[model samples]
Target: MIATRDAYGEALAKLGEENDNIVVLDADLSGSTKTSLFAKKFPERFFNMGIAEANMIGTAAGLAAAGKIPFASTFAIFAVGRAWEQVRQSVAYPKANVKIVATHSGITVGEDGGSHQSVEDIAIMRAVPNMTVIVPADGIETALAVKAAADFKGPVYVRLGRNKVPTIFDDTYKFEIGKGVMLRPGTDITFIGTGLMTAQALVAADLLQAEGISARVIHIATIKPLDEEIILAAARETGAIVTAEEHSIIGGLGGAVSELLSEKCPTKLKRVGIKDRFGLSGKGDELLKYFGLLPENLVEAAKEILAEK
Candidate 1:
């Protein structure tokens, strides 16, 4: 198992070798955010902006204006919450080629409590006009996402977690900005998931298979600019939908899928995520299970949705 933030740091370091225009910026959490690895590799190109997230974001914007591909790293709460106005006014407004890779997002930043955790980051980022929002499933997907974000020209927000997670993708996996990948094929019901919840969805599929139920599993890596075509196809085929994410159901992955289906397909759907509540401090796995984001919870949701169908 590997943490996505670990893959992010390694990917940024490798990208530095390939592109000379690439630079890294961090607020005070380089060690936790793992951007310190890049700083070690390229001291000249790394900028430690201290504990000032707003300043760090503005500095990244300036670097983008100077034709540098700046990657800003920090905790999700500070990156989005503390410096939201700066990010909105500076980088995203200009459509800068700045990558904001935030680690320890959602309820997985265990033991940090609700104040440090960020459940609204994805929602706010998706609301921005020119920003691209992505939440990779695992370390392998995180590497691919970092590389893809670098090549794409725009403001990108990549959300990663702190704990090590099961690898869902291999070396052959290809990640597109606004495309969903189907991991398993089924006709009874469809499970659309993002982040670590995608792994749980796969597990739920296995459990359902034992009960003679065919469940289709689709991983949505890109939250904003969602793959509506793929989702609509799934709704047309499966007839029922269940969305899982390591975020609140209000305005995250669940909300995005709900909006899409309501406008286009209008199918029976169930969302598996935090029920618009704040996360408490605990172990990552425990918090996930407590919030009903486990495979068993997904199985129950699928069965309930299937019964309605």
Candidate 2:
């Protein structure tokens, strides 16, 4: 029952009640994106833009200009692709108080395939100036990020998945934006993952324990303004790093880490993700298993990284 998407929708509705300045807009995907719950409660504050992501983004910008905090919801693909220019021009450039809540990110959209899947959303969003990108690990983090974004006076992109996984936190994990959470202690290697892959890294670390392999699991929820100090410390201690992401190997968390490590620490690193391929119709888990995001795949990657070390 670890659906962060559900928590995001619920948090938005709750946050709306507390903050009168908060407003919500969806691109005709209130049901799938889970913003319908907010619409049902705060009908006057919620706006449905009828499948037009670009228009929704522009509308959000106008709301922000008028001293209102607007949250726009849509699929990850649409938020990053269809509404990219609008996001860049209206939200990021001016640094508006617009929160972009994108659901079903990565291949978790499953049977909807590549068209609906968003592997490059983070990279694109992060590259924009003044955009804060967040990939919450579970429901709690999602709720926390949603609540925090309303306070921050800038464009924030929060990514959440659709699948139901295990609740890794004890309802006490402090999810601070731009801070990475270290879940396990290890010296041999550092396993860095974001979004859904963070859970995989945790499970992989447990499997590595039986083999006497000490691998640290670092949950990188914030992607844009990366926590470089934490990453550098882990790299300095472990000497080897393995990155797991549900995005392409090009420019997501893997790219962010590689960029920092190459210039800062020059640590040995291995990246696991999609290799510039599009997904097709299939269940969520099937795509993950196919894309080498399974626990077995992570264990194998860790073994390979350790071998090099």
Candidate 3:
């Protein structure tokens, strides 16, 4: 098991070796965001942007305009909430080659309370034009995503969490931007999950299998420009859908899937995430359970959708 941010830091350092134009900027949270690994390897290319999140974003945009791939790192809340105007006006609007890889996202931020936790970052970033949003499932996926973000042009936002999670994908796993991977096949219901919840979806699939539920698990690593083809296929095949994420049920993965299915298929759907409420200080695992984001909750949601079907 490994934290996705750890993989991201390692991947950024490795990418720096191959691409000299790759630079890193952090708003005084390199250690928390794990960008310190990259700073250690490429100190000259790393810029400590102090506590000014907006300034860090503007500097990254300037670096991008000068032909550098600037990776801006900070807490998710600060990156999206504090520096949103700069991100929208400087980086995203100009389609700059900037990667905003924010860590410590969601209720899993743990003990930091609602102010530190970022439940709406995904929604707001996805709303920006020319901005690609990604939520990798595991360390392997995170590494691939970092590489993908470096290679892809324009603005990108990659959301990562603080807690260590189960390694769901192997080295053989290939990640494609805006594509969803079907981890398990089923005919009864589809469990569409993103970020760490994708790992939970796999576990929930096992629990359902024992009960002959036949749940299909689809991991959505890319939230923006969603894999509509794959999602529609799952909805058509399974007839019922359950979307899970570590963020809010409003405009994260659940909202994206709900929008797609409503327009394309209109399948029975349930969302597993923090309802319209703020996160509180607690242990990471405890927070997940408190918000009903565990495998048992997913299994129950699947059963409910099945019952309705």
Candidate 4:
């Protein structure tokens, strides 16, 4: 197991060695955000912008305009909340090649309380017209996603967790922007998930399989340009769908899937996520359970949705 933030740091450092145009900016959280690793390797290419996330974003946009691939690092809350206007106007609006790699996202930013944990980052980032939102499930996927984001142009938002999560993908796995991968195949129900919840969905599928329920697991790393074709196919085949995420059910992965299925397919669905509430100060695992983001919660949601189907 490894933290996605750690993988991001390593990937950034490696990308630095490979690409000269790749530059990094951080909002005084080099250590926590893990951008410090890249800073250590490429001090000249890294700029520690201090606690000013807004300024950091603006600087990144400027660098991007100067024909550089600038990666801005900060916590999800500060990146999306504190520097939202700058991100919208300076980066997304102009389609700048700025990668807003925000770490310590979701309730996994445990012990920091509601102010630090950012459950709405995905939704807000996804809402941006030109922004590409990605939430990698594990370390391997995070590394691959970081590389993919660097190769791709325009504005990008990569959400990462603080705690060490189970490695869901191996070295052989491929990462693509705006694509969803089916990890497990089934027919009775479909569990579409993003971020760390994708790993949990896999576990939920296992538990359901033992009980004679064939649950399909689909991991959607990209939330903005959702894989509608795969999702619509799952809905048509399974007749029921459950979306799990370590975010609010309001406008995150759940909302995206719900909107897609409602207009296109109209499938029986249950969204397993934070119920439009602030995060509490506690351990990461405890927060997940408290917010009903556990495998058991997903399994329960699956059964409920399946019964309706």
Candidate 5:
């Protein structure tokens, strides 16, 4: 198991070696955000912008305009909450090649409490125009997504977790910008998951299989430009859907899937996520279980949705 932030740091360092134009800016959080690895390797290419998150974003935008691929790093709450206007006007509006790779996202930001945890980052970033939002499930996917964001031109927001999560993919796995991968296949129900929840969805599928319930698991790495085709097909074929994410049910993966399915194909759905509330200070795994974000929660949601179906 490895924290996605650790993978991001290693990937950014490797990317620095490959591309001279790749520059990194961090808001006084190089150590926590793991951009410190890049700083250690290529100090010239890295700029520690102090505690000013908004200024860091603007600087990154300027660097992007100067024909450089700038990656801005910080905590998810500060990146999306504090520097939202700069992100919207300076980066997204002009479609600058600024990659806002935020770490310590979601309730996994443990012990920092609700003020630091960013459960609503995905919702707000997803709402921004010209912003591509990604929530990679594990380290392998995080590395692939980081490379993909660096390659693609435009504003991108990649949300990463603080805690070490189970590795869900290997070298054989292929990662795309706007694609969903089906990890497990089933006919009865589908669990559409993003971020750390994807790993839990797979566990839930296994648990369900033992109980004679065939549950399909789909991992959605990209939140914006959602894989509508895959979701629609899952809804049409399975007749039931459950969305799990380390975010609010409102305007996150659950909201996106609900909107798509409601318009295109109405399917019985259940969302397993934070229920419009702030995070509490606690251990990461305990918080996940406390908020019903474990595999058992997905199992319960699946059974409920299947019963309705």
Candidate 6:
């Protein structure tokens, strides 16, 4: 089973045990956010803010100012939208050591539907000057990103999927903020994705491989302050690009890549994601399939994109 929730939980638990400076705060969502591990291990350092996301961000900012590495937990919407002002003024402006750990992000929140979905979180968070935005592909990387965020000095928004996802990379792979991982290399076309879409991109690559199409898949783990070198290289290597994501195509991974590639290589690109619409209540996979973000969807987009060559 592919699951990043437990990975984040275990990572926070380890951080709390090893670093005295680490503090965890949740919007009374300890169980759902998987922050119960930190609360259980370090009860004194854990704060259950009782659904006040703005207060949680403010408190986390305060904790950071006091030399504590605070990780505030909430649904992605609350973290970016509800607490946006505090994040901008208190954390990003001052460059505080506050980590906003948002679980249940994107349409992956499933039955929660349009209300809980965080489709615009990336566009919103990425606009912050000092904010570092990260969307790990799976459980293992989420764990690593958690540790890496602890090392970062300023504000961070670590966007995580709600469900279990395949562990595509082993421990041998190293992770660093502002760096993207290039998985499959191809000269024909490039498939770039982040979070759950990366897994789908891997599957799409396998399918495309069988059809005599070479597709390079890259995981954009760090969204904001994107690795332009890797992106521009992909555009230079492959003439066309296909970007998939569990977010709106307007301002998420696709928009970011397009913005970079436009100024650089100016390649042919197509984005597969929520097409300017909110999601409905259903199973996660159902919503993903409905939004055309599945492997099959990427395969079709890839084939259509490569046909231009």
Query: Across residues 102-164, which tens digit of lDDT does each residue of candidate 2 receive?
Result: 998889889877888888888899899999999988888888889888888799999988888
lDDT of 1 by residue, 1-309 (tens): 999999999999999999999999999789999999999999999999999999999999999999999999999989999999888999999898899999999999999999988888888888888989999999999999999999999999999999999998999998999999999999999999999999999999999999999999999999988999999999999999999999888888989999999999999999999888888999999899888989999999999998888
Candidate with more favorable, higher lDDT: 5 or 6: 5
RMSD of each: 0.7, 0.9, 0.6, 0.6, 0.5, 0.9
Query: How far does residue 91 in candidate 1 sit from its true spot (Å)?
Result: 1.1
> Which residue segments of model 6 deviate by more than 4 Å?
none
Q: List the residue pairs that clash in candidate 6.
A: 2-164, 2-165, 3-164, 3-165
State the displacement of the C-alpha of residue 24, model 5, in Å, after optimal TM-score superposition: 0.3
Tens digit of per-residue lDDT, candidate 3, span 135-247: 99899999999999999998999999888999999989998898899999999999999999999999999999999889999999999989999999999999999999999
Q: Kindly report which residue stretches of model 3 are placed more than 4 angstroms away from their true locations once superposed.
A: none
Count clashing pairs, candidate 3. Answer: 0
RMSD of 5: 0.5
Model 5 whole-model lDDT (C-alpha atoms): 0.96
Error of 5 at 253 (Å): 0.3
RMSD of 6: 0.9
Cα lDDT tens digits, model 6, 180-204, are 9999888789999999889899999
Candidate 4 residue lDDT tens string, 185-300: 99999999999999999999999999999999999999989999899999999999999999999899999999999999999999998888899899999999888899999999
- TM-scores of all models? 0.99, 0.98, 0.99, 0.99, 0.99, 0.98
- lDDT by residue (1-309, candidate 5, tens digit) is 999999999999999999999999999999999999999999999999999999999999999999999999999999999999999999999999999999999998999999999999999999999999999999999999999999999999999999999998999999999999999899999999999999999999999999999998999999999999999999999999999999999999999999999999999999999999999999999999999999999999998877777
Quality of model 1 by C-alpha lDDT? 0.94
Among these predictions, the greatest lDDT belongs to: 5
Better of 1 and 2 by TM-score: 1
Candidate 2: list runs displaced more than 4 Å.
none
TM-score of the candidate numbered 1? 0.99
